[model samples]
Target: MSDHAVSGVPGGPVRESRDVADLMRWFGDAWVLPLLVGGTSLVIGILLIVWPNVTVTAVAVLFGVYLLIYGVFRLIESFAADEAGGTARVLLALLGVLSIVVGVLCLRNILQTVVLLALLLGLFWLVGGIIQVVAAILQRSRPHRGLTMVSGVLAVLAGVVVLSYPGISLLVLTVFLGIWLVVYGVLMILGAFRLRAAGRRSVEVTGGAAAAPAG
Candidate 1:
C-alpha cells in the first residue's frame, strides 16, 4: 500500500507529506539569514579589534547589540527545527532566553556587564575547548586531527587566561572577545553555505521523487 492509503484518510497523508517538504524547503532557503547575521558579527568584531581603545560604555553597548541579535537568530533557528521536537527544542529555547536576558542586563549596566561577560566568555571558551579536544580524539583518523588538537589546546589556554585575569582592562577584554567573534562569524558563514547546498539537494530529490512513475 502507498503512504496515502496507509494514512487511511483521503488526501491526509499527501497533504502532510507536502507540508513537511515545504517546511524543509523553507528551512533550507532561510540559510541566508544566518549568513547575514554572521557577516554582521564579523563586521562588529573587526570594528572592536581595530578600535580597541573605545570606551567601556561603547564596548558594552556593542556587546549588548550583538547578544540581542544572536539571541533572536538562535530562537528563529530553534523554532525552525520543529521536527527535532522535545528536549532539543526546549534547550534551544532556554538558551535563547538566557542570551536575551544577559543582553538586556548588559545594556542596563555597563560596568557590571563587563565582569559578567568576562566570566561567560571564559566559561564558553573552556567548554568549547574541551568539546573540541574530545571530538579530535574521537576522530583521530581525520587528516587534520593534529591541527584540531592544537586549536583546542589554544582555546583552553585562552579560556584559562581570561578567567585568571578577569579583572583585566576593558580594552584587553574587547580585543579577546573581538578575535573570538571573528572566528565564530567565519564558521557561521561557512555553515550557511553548507545549508544552502543541502537545501538544493533536497529540492532536487523531492523533484525526482515527484516525477517518478507510480507502480
Candidate 2:
C-alpha cells in the first residue's frame, strides 16, 4: 500500500513542493535589487577607502537610522514572543537587546560596518561559487551532468559579477531583492491553492470508491 493510503493523510504541506521553484524565481527576479545594494555598499566602501575623513560622519548617520528601525522591530517581536511564552522567548529578548546595541554601535561606526559587510559578501560569493564548481565537476559523469555544470557555471558567474562590480547603489539592490521576495510570496500562495486542489481531487476519488462499494 502507498504511504498516503496507510497514513490517510490527503496531502503534504504546500511549502515543500513549491519551495524550490518559488525560491528560484524569487532569487532570479530579485537579482537587480541585490546588485544595487552591493553596488551602493561598494561605492560607500570605495569612498571610505579613498576619503577616510568623510567616512565617520556618513557611516554614523546611515548606521544610526538603520539600527534604530531594526532595533524597534526586534524589540517588539521579542516582547510579543515573551508575552506568549514561546520557546526561546528569553533568547529572542536577548537577541533584540543585542541587535539594539549593535545598531547603536553601527551608528558610531557605520563606515566600518559597510566595509566589513562588503568584504564578507564578496568572500561568500567566491567561496560559494567554488563549492558549486567542485560539486558540478564531481557530478560530471552523471546523466544530468550538462545541466548541473551549467548551473554551477552560472553560480560562479554571478559571484564573479558581484565581486567585479561592488560599487552599485543600495536602492537598486533593494528593488531587486523586493522583486524576488514578491515572486516567492506569490508562488507560495499559488502552491497553497494547488495543494487545496489536490486535496479536493483526492476526496472526490475516495468518495466515488466508497459509494461504489455501497452500491
Candidate 3:
C-alpha cells in the first residue's frame, strides 16, 4: 500500500501531493532509523558533556553499544537489500566486526582515555582544511573559492588553538560543542514542530474534504 495520498486542501479542488521529500532530503528514506539513532546519540553526547566525569565511562560504553548494534544492523540489512552485492555484504560484515572490536577496546581503555580527543579532532580539521585549500587551488575556476578559503582558514585556526593548548582545549572544546548542540537541538525541535503542524493541517484538510457535501 502507498504511504501517502494526494487529496484536495480544505480551500479548493487543488490536489495536494503528500511528499515524503523532507524525510528523503534529511536522510534517504532507508536511513531514517539510523538518523533517529544518531539523533539519540547526540542527546546522549550533550548529557555526557554536562557531566563529563560521570559520563566519560558511560559515553564510551554507549558508543560501544551503539556501534555494535549499528554494525549488526548493517550486516543484516546488507543481506536483505538487493542493491547490496557480495562486496557490499563483505564490507558490512567487516564493519560490524570492526565496530564491535572498537567498542570493546573503548570500554577497556576508558580509564586511560585522555581528554586529547579535541586535539585529534583539530588535527583532522587541519588536514581537511589543507585538502580544501589544495582543491580550491586546483579548481580556481569555481565560484566557491571564497567560501572554501574561509573554511580552510577557520579549520586551520581551530586546529592551531587545540594543538597549542591541548590542556585548555578540553574546556574550550566542550563549550564550543555545547553551543553547537544548543543550536542543533533548537533547529531539530523547530523542524519537528513544523512537521507536526503540516501533518495536522493535512489531517484537517482531509477531514474537511470528507465532510463536504457531494456535488
Candidate 4:
C-alpha cells in the first residue's frame, strides 16, 4: 500500500500531518529563502532608482509590496527553531503585523501614507541614532568609538532633515528609499550566506557525532 494508505491504516495520519507541518515550518530556515528575498529587494531597489520619475502612486504601491514581502520574511525568520527565542518571536510577529498594516494603509492612501511613513522613518532614525550614540559613549575605549559617534550624529542629522522637510520632492524620497533598500538587500544576502555556512557546520558536527562509536 502507499504511504498515505499505510498512515491511514494505523491512525498514523495525525502524526504524518504533524510531520508535514513541521517540515513546512522548517523549510524557511534554508539559506536559499533569504537569498531569494534579498534578490527581490535588490530588483525592487534598482527599479526605483532607475525610474525615479515613476508616479507617486506607483512608488507607494511598490513600497507596500516591499513591506508585505519583508513582513512575510520576518514571520518566516521568527519560526526558525535555531534562531529566535519566544520573546524575539513575539516581537518579530508584532513587527510583521505592523509592517502589513502600514503596507496596506500605504496602498490605500498614497500621498498621506508616504508622508506619514517619512515621519515615522525619521522618528525611528532619531531614536536609533540616540541609542547608538549612548552605546558608543559607553564604549568610549573602543578604537572605533569616534566613528560610531560620527555615524550616530549623521543619522540624527538625517532624521532631523527628513522631519524638517516632510514635504520633500518625490524624486529625492525615492532616491533615499532606493539606496536604503539596496543596502538592506545586500546585507540580507550576506546574512544568508552566513546562515548557510552555519548550517553546513551544524550538519558536519551532527554527522561526525552520528558516525562516532559510542560505548
* lDDT tens digits by residue: candidate 4, 1-215: 86546655654754545554445434425778778877887888899899898777787788778778877875765565333346555555655565666667667764555577677656644754565466556543333346545655765776787889888777887887777667667766776776666556655555554444434
In model 4, where do residues sit more than 4 Å from their true spots?
Answer: 1-29, 81-83, 110-114, 120-161
Worst 10 residues of 1 by lDDT: 139-148
Ranking by TM-score: 1, 4, 3, 2
**Each prediction's TM-score versus the true structure:** 0.74, 0.30, 0.40, 0.68
Candidate 1 Cα outliers beyond 4 Å, as residue runs? 1-18, 110-117, 120-160
Q: Which residues of candidate 3, in runs, are more than 4 Å off?
A: 1-36, 52-55, 115-215
Error of 4 at 187 (Å): 0.2
Tens-digit lDDT track for model 1 on 1-215? 77647665755655555665786688678888878877977988999999998877687678678778877876785576554454545545655565677667667764555577677657655755665566556543333345545655766877898999878778889998788778767766776777787777777787566555455
Query: Mind sharing the TM-score for model 3?
Result: 0.40
Evaluated at residue 111, the lDDT of candidate 3 is: 35
- RMSD of candidate 3 to the truth, in angstroms, is 11.1
Q: lDDT of all predictions, in order shown?
A: 0.69, 0.42, 0.48, 0.64
In terms of lDDT, which candidate is stronger, 1 or 2?
Answer: 1
Q: Kindly report which residue pairs in candidate 2 clash with one another.
A: 33-173, 33-176, 36-169, 36-173, 37-173, 39-167, 39-168, 40-168, 40-169
Clashing pairs in 3: none
Q: In the order shown, what is each candidate's alpha-carbon RMSD?
A: 5.5, 13.8, 11.1, 9.0
